[model samples]
Target: MPFIDLRAQYAALKPSIDARIQRVLDHGQYIMGPEVQELEQALAAYVGTQHCITVASGTEALLIALMTLDLQPGDEVITTPFTFAATAEVIVLLGGVPVFVDIEPDTLNIDPTQIEAAITPRTRAIMPVSLYGQVADMDAINAIAARHGGLPVIEDAAQSFGASYGGTAGTPRESGSAPRGKSCGLSTWGATSFFPSKPLGCYGDGGALFTNDAALAQAAREIRVHGQSQRYTHTRVGVGGRMDTLQCAIVLGKLERFDWEVAQRLAIGERYQRLIGDLPLQRLAVREDRDCVWAQFTVQVDHREAVIESLKQAGIPTAVHYPKPLHRQPAYEARSRAATPLPNAEAAARRVMSLPMSADLSEAQQDQVVAALRVALT
Candidate 1:
């Protein structure tokens, strides 16, 4: 049993993918072809954003967003410690500080209530990671940022590109709960990954930045092209961060059924939640106001190592989204501002385990994973 099942996704989208690839090959403008802009436009529309700038990778998307904001040597970016290193790495790379905050126990997202207290004169931005395919409290986060002299809020939506937001947490379902906004559309800069394992991914490394602010969008566009306002013009210091045409073509093909795929992911996640409800494990909390795309069907369990081994014996695959909080990591321990104890983040790190998940994952495979967990725990 494969962990992600990318091959199955490829097989399903082979026709469109092949034709798109062939078109790109025939054009031979591989650097920044028409497909790149086409993809950017398509994504902008889908995400309900004014501009979508495709970048070389998600890390580049973060770096460029910071660069576009003109983050300084001592500038601080508030973020969660319970996320991939790239979330904090980008801030440190640009000579900026990452102020680590605790996360909510239920959703594993950065706690919004803890953010304002962390803000200081040096704070330049608030970056919240939409960990494991669910958005954080953007409405409240944005409100906090607004109170702080209009600080930029960047959504590190690496795992949640297709997730929808705008439902109130701790509330009952509203009738016809239409999507209020997509992950990338709800912030000053929404950055998402196209890593193969993500909910909406291309074949290889790719990422994008979405924003409604024209100035910031233009800044990101120039920064992505080595700070060029025109050909061979270096207006500002930048990096090689443009997403290649081939990758854009592949992503375009994937979009042929992306709406359907997102829907499937949500349904599969709900079904998994129900199946594992009675199990001796803590399922991730999905708020009623929004939906999760289930980039990874993760859950919290005890004796994680033994359970993982038991699943392995049963021919089921499992993974940990992240095992260590960034503040506990060697590189970031000295760099983070631990204003308060990250009890929930620390606890989640020890228990969270991701099961094999994909749009192609079958119900039988899901049952097998649950049965293995039942045996493993016993």
Candidate 2:
């Protein structure tokens, strides 16, 4: 079984994908072509955001978001250490400090209550990661940010682009009665990846920044093209972060069936949750207000390495979304400032493992995985 099954996805969307790619080639505007704007507009409408700025990579998306915020040296960005290094790596790259906060033991997302205590005069932003396709406590985090000088909150939504948050228009959406806003539209800034494994992936490296703030959106646009306010005018220090036209074309093709794909992901994720209920593993918690797109259908198991090896032997593929927390990494340990205890993040790193997951995953395949896991634990 493929860990992510990107081949299957490509096969399913072959015709449109081919057409989109062909159109891009015919136009010969490889860099910043019409397809780029086409994708930005489409995704912006889908995400319910005022602006969508495509970038070269997910890392570049985060970096550009921070650059637009004008994060200065010694400034702090509060975030969870339990996510991909990119979450905190961007902060450190800007000559800023990454204030690490522990995650909820159940959700494995940044604990919102732990955020305020980590704030200081140096705090410039609060970044919460939507891990394994589940959103963090965004409403609570937003409230905290509002109480503290209206600090910018960036949602590291790389894994949760199709996911929805519970609240909309100052109303709670826990009951599912009200419409839920999409992940990228819920924060001051939402950055998502288009890596092949993500819920909404492009053929190559790509990402998008979403926001409602016009000034911030304009700054991101400028920063994306070598900080050019106009042609060849370097208004500020910026990186070459613009997503290529070809990659944008690929994403637009994928969007043809994205809604169906998201629905499939939701059903698959829910089925996996049900199938594994009796297994000797702890399933990641899903809040009632939101849904996971199953970017990685992860679960916590004892003897995680042994489980992985057993699955591998049974012709089943598995992976750890992150084997080590960023704070424990050699590069980030010294650079991170932790105000909350990291015991949960530490324990989660050792126990957490992701199962084979994709919108195209089948029930029989899921059952085979569960049966193998059941035997492995025995």
- Steric clashes per prediction: 1, 0
| Candidate 1, 1-378: lDDT as tens digits | 788999999999999999999999999999899999999999999999999999999999999999999998889999999999999999999889999889999999999999999999999999999989999988789889988899999999999998888743234344443236889888899999998888888888999999999999988888988889999998888888999999999999999989889888988899899988888999999887778898888999999999999899999889997899998999998877786789999999999999988998888888887788888888
Error of 2 at 73 (Å): 0.6
lDDT of 2 at 174: 47
| Model 2 residue pairs with clashes | none
Tell me each candidate's TM-score: 0.97, 0.97
Q: RMSD to native for every prediction?
A: 2.3, 2.2
Q: What is candidate 2's CA lDDT for residue 63?
A: 95
Candidate 1 — what's its lDDT? 0.90
**Mind giving the per-residue lDDT tens digits that candidate 2 earns over 1-378?**
888888999999999999989998898999999999999999999999899999998889999999999999999999999999898889999999999989999999999989999999999999999999988888788889989989999999999988877753233654623235888888899999999889999978999999999999999999999999999999988888989899999999899999999999999988988988988889999887678888999999999888889999999999897899998899988988888889999999999999999988889999999999998888
